[model samples]
Target chain A: MITFDKTTKTYDGGVTAVKGVDFTVEKGEIVVLLGPSGCGKTTLLRMVNRLESISDGKIMIDGEDSMSLDSIELRRKIGYVIQSNGLFPNMTIEENVMIVPDLLGWSKKDKKERFKKLMNMISMDSEKFGKRYPHELSGGQQQRIGVIRALAADPPVMLMDEPFGALDPIIREKIQDEFLQIQKEVKKTILFVSHDIDEAIRMADKIVLLRGGELMQYDTPSEMLVRPKSEFVREFFGKDRAIKSLSLHTIRELQDIIGLAEFDEGITDTITINVNHDLRNTLSMLLNQEADQVIVVDDEGNKLGAITIDIVQKYLHFEIKAKPTLVEKG
Target chain B: MDKWLKFLEINAPRIFDLTIEHAILVGAAILVALLIGVPLGIYLTTNDYLAETVLQIASVMLTIPSIALFGVMIPIFSIVNLGIGFVPAFVALVLYAQLPIIRNTYTAIRNVDPEMRDAAIGLGMKPIQRLFRVEIPNAFPVIMAGIRTAVVINIGIGVIAAYIGAGGLGVLITQGITRGDNYLIITGSVAVAILAMIADGFLMWIQKRYTPKSIAN
Candidate 1:
């Protein structure tokens, strides 16, 4: 666990890069630091590794002060990956991955073993890639090396700074999915930084939205998107806010909310979709199941109201004046 | 034989030996300089507070006139009598040679991408390990080029120590002038130039060998 307690950094002449940041990266969770350019998300992430020292307050890893450890040792203990996948141009892939273990004075056998494990984890064939210099690999391949190099030591803490920002969309999505799977297996505490809100929504267990180095919002991506604390966040999440909301809920979640569909009483009546799912996906589910109407259920899986095309349209266009209704709670 | 003929005849073998002697001195100096200078160069690159200071000091030491500089070290150690004659000259050459190799090593390592530095650090390299494993190895080509330049220059200068009984081809040149023997001068001067060319070729070979083959394209 890591916590920033009123951590602030003010440069000379008082340009505060970060101002009183207070957040915690929970264990085994991907906490994304997200914001627009110059929002200081990158600075906040760098502070964790002490790449930039804080001006005031404290950052604690577990219960220990982050400043207490030697900077080099502290950096070595946490994995860091950056946007460009900054590989040492002079080194081969295997040498790049083994950089840390070599630094730690691991024996030749240990270095080789770690390299093999990391390459396997990143899906790079050690035999093909191990001897190839960084220049030899393509863009996506190099990024994998960047990621696995950080993971070589298998540290519990990982810091990534816009790791997916440079790749093409297809490659970007693949790496993101791969990272998600890797995170599940390794379960390291991760602080991922990006300006892409959709990525934050997809990746972060906790999303931290920063503006001018000030903490604007820190919450789950779903909450942050639906209930932005400021106009800045709403604008930053931008025009596709509704689509991003849907991404979190999923087609399965909205299966019950498909606009208006006429229902028929088939003796006992019929419905599709489980009672427990997000209301945002209600429309798509109705269209796919080819059902005229689906029964919306309450907490105990009891039928509350049936959703047809018209009803779901009402739910879509109409803001629930009472409260944000959970479809499962309908 | 006539006066000039006898002079050349008597000193021909001596001239050949002097060339070999000066070649060995410069070669030994570069080796010893590289041993001390490379690590210092690494340190200078990673550590900024002293980099400019150390670099300037080395540059200043190298720029002073060689005869005047060697004259200064002669009294400091009382090494004139202790079989330290050639060794002390070797030491001066090493010190003089350091400015180029050390500066280039520092430049090469410092010029390495900061992203690469961050990546190495991110990947768990402690500073010392990164210096030897990544930084030093990456900087070698440029550093070797600097060393090559220094070697040729040092070999050219190394013969000058003969002015003070540090026997080499310079002894023949200085002696020939004092005794009115042009043959000695020609013989002595040829030895120095040939040694410089050969030393330069060797340095070029070393530089080429270490230069990454992949850079050719």
Candidate 2:
């Protein structure tokens, strides 16, 4: 849905914050701009909304050059979220969420309806919290409001700059899961900026890695993890890349590749995990509980079979060895 | 004590009139200062050099003794043939008020959480729309505070305006000093003090009433 054609940003004094970066974000896919600080990930994202003016080349959104449209008009058509969850402190929750709609001149009734729907999406009761200000909510709730506020106008595109970066780790993880759940219902074409490697791996359909304003690599999280294009890419993912890659594969993928081990009913000291749980968590669970096996259940709590440490290792071996060749051949 | 009370009872009417005059002088100065300082402050936020220059000038102006400022205003306004009374006093008060109003306004608007400004820009708010709806509203409490400071300071200084024949409580004090009547001086000083407190209290109410509830605490 969005294509960056050698997009570049040069500030005064001959300093380039974003160098000739080229990438494409597919429709309804989350493309995360992943880089360390000063790598220009944020500068690139801001260029899309013309917040940071593009100095050279172009960014095409929905086949139209971004610069060709009025900056304000282009921005209104896109959702924007920042790390601070920038809800207007002066406005109540309802007014803050309905900002874009108000800007669009939507009727009061229409704005109220959209506000209700957005509050509902975050599972926040509109009547209970509508008149409350941004400070009244917790960090996570405020971030949720920030997200829905962007989604308020139902813009086709979204630019999120570490929307959950401010929350504590536990809350951050929970909100990240909640955001992903929301994304499933509203599949926006998103350009996400994140310095957190784990967040990019978990949320992005594609990761655009950068270093010092230069594009390091752009590929699926798994591809980038498994077959890094450069030494920096490998280092960026870190020494536990094989283990980190486990997060991208689910229990279902492992079951399909190599069937689960038999369930021993006599093994009373065991735990159960859902079938949809990622292999990384499953591995951690196995190690943490030190149980012989874990009973794996489907959505309806039907026990499919049991899985063990040995089975996870075997699947990991199969995945690491088998996928690279397939990717190469493809 | 009997002499003080009797003096207060006798001059109560005159004191009331002077208090009203004192209030009008301060009020008009603050109102005009708001009109000038607020916009100038907002404008300064957009221009760095101008903000520095204007704030520095205001600071220097603030350091001038209110009496000295009133003194300077005499000659400046006299060139127009009407320097002695209300005009010089009014202009002097406005000049004195600028430091607080402009400084607070410039700082408040300039310091509005940058994240908020970025969000406003990102959400596609027009420049004017952002200024009115986001920047100014968020900056309200501080701007009101500046006005309050200006009002309180001007009320005290408004007493000085009577020296130039502007007709405020200062007349009692100045004339009493000339004639050696401590009763008039005491009444004038106490009256001015009460007026400052009441005016500040009124402004405090306004600041609270209009400050965005979200950040009021």
Candidate 3:
């Protein structure tokens, strides 16, 4: 766990970039620091690795005072990804991903194994891309190398500062989904910083909302959507709170009410969605197909349940309570 | 044109010796300047105040006329009992070469993408590691360009070194001027120009060869 106890960052000019902020990131959780520019979100994320010094209070990592640890050693244990991919231009993609491991003195055989595993994790052909330099790859591919480079040493904590900010919308969505899949397997404690509300909602296990170096709200995405503490956060979530909330839920969340709808043979032609599909996509499918309900299937294409518009509406209206179980299981 | 060819044929042996001397003078001076200037340039990047002072001094050196700088070097070398001959000429040429070499080194290192440095540091690379692995490799092309400029300029200024008794292609030109022989002067001037072109082409090839293929674009 990483704990911030009244951490404050005051610049030489007496401008407090992060003011007495406190929070704890549980292991295997992805906590996002969401805010506008100059709100200290980046500062807070950087402070954890000692890239930005804190003027007051303390940061404890795994219950040890972080300041007492060697800054280099501290940083080595925490993976860091930045807005620009930051791959060394002179090095090839394989060498880039293996940098941290190489530094940590992993044997040649071990480095080779990790290199193949990381490339395969991203579905990149290790043999073909391994020899190619960062400039030779597209922006999204470079970012994948950037992300995997951080994971090269198997560091328990990962810090990403707008890792996908530079990509086009389609590439960004694709990478975000790919990253989510990787996160499920790695389960590293992650502190992600992003200004995009939709990105924050989609990736964060918990969102720490800040404005002008002050914490406005610290809650799960669903809770924040349902009960915004201040007008700033509510406004920040934008005007379409209900529709946005649908994205926070998946079709499987209402599985308890699934058996109520009969899996009739006549309705076999209805649109089929995976159980893990988000409620927003399910609703869009319903409207597009002009059907009141849709068949949901498991990964094996076995019909698991039927999701109706009535359940989606009830869940959106808070008529049904969603117990916060692990979403990665699906 | 016939006179020039006749002059080259008659003075071929002497011209050959003088050409060797010219190459040695320029080559040695550039070698010394690179040894001193490259590190100084790298050092300047880390120390802003020193960079400003050193670069200012180098720029000032460039503004002094080559003849005047050679004259200045004569007295300094004579005081150290190494007067005239190749020592003073070599010293003058080295001083002249410093501006381009140092400036290029400083600018190349400074121009390295700041984001790359941040990424390097964030990944726990030591200051020295980042300098060698990231900064130097990226700055290499510009640094090589600087060296090329310095060498070419040194070649031109090296002709003036003959006045200080350093034998070179300039010897033919000086002798031709004294004897009022335009053909001898033309031969010396043409040889020096050709030599400069050859050196520039060689360094350009080296620069292209050494630049990483990924960043060649």
Once model 1 is optimally superposed onto the true structure by TM-score, how far is the C-alpha of residue A243 displaced, in angstroms? 3.1
lDDT tens per residue, model 2, B1-217: 8987887798889999988988888888889999999999999998999889999999998888878888888888889988899999999999999999999999999999999999999999999999999999999999988998899889888888987889898998998999998888888899999999998998899899998988786
Task: Give the Å error, residue A108, model 1.
Answer: 4.8
Cα lDDT of model 2 by residue, A102-172, tens digit? 99999999999988888888889999999999998999999999999999999999999999899999999
Compared with the true structure, what per-residue lDDT tens digits does model 1 show for residues A193-304?
9888768888889999998999999999877766777778778877566546655763233444443233445625467554455455565676676655576655566555
Ranking by TM-score: 2, 3, 1
Candidate number with greatest DockQ: 2
B-chain TM-score of model 1:
0.86
DockQ of 2: 0.92
> Judged by TM-score, which candidate is best?
2
Cα lDDT tens digits, model 3, A150-249, are 9999999999999999999999999999999999999999999999988999999999999999889999998887677777887888767667778887
Question: Which stretches of candidate 2 lie above 4 Å from their native place?
Answer: A323-330
- Clash counts per candidate, in order, are 17, 0, 0
Q: Comparing chain B with the reference, what is the TM-score for each candidate? A: 0.86, 0.96, 0.95
Q: By lDDT, highest first, what's the ranking?
A: 2, 3, 1
Error of 1 at A141 (Å): 0.5
Worst 10 residues of 3 chain A by lDDT: A321-330
Task: For candidate 2, give the docking quality class from DockQ.
Answer: high
Residue pairs with backbone overlap in model 2: none
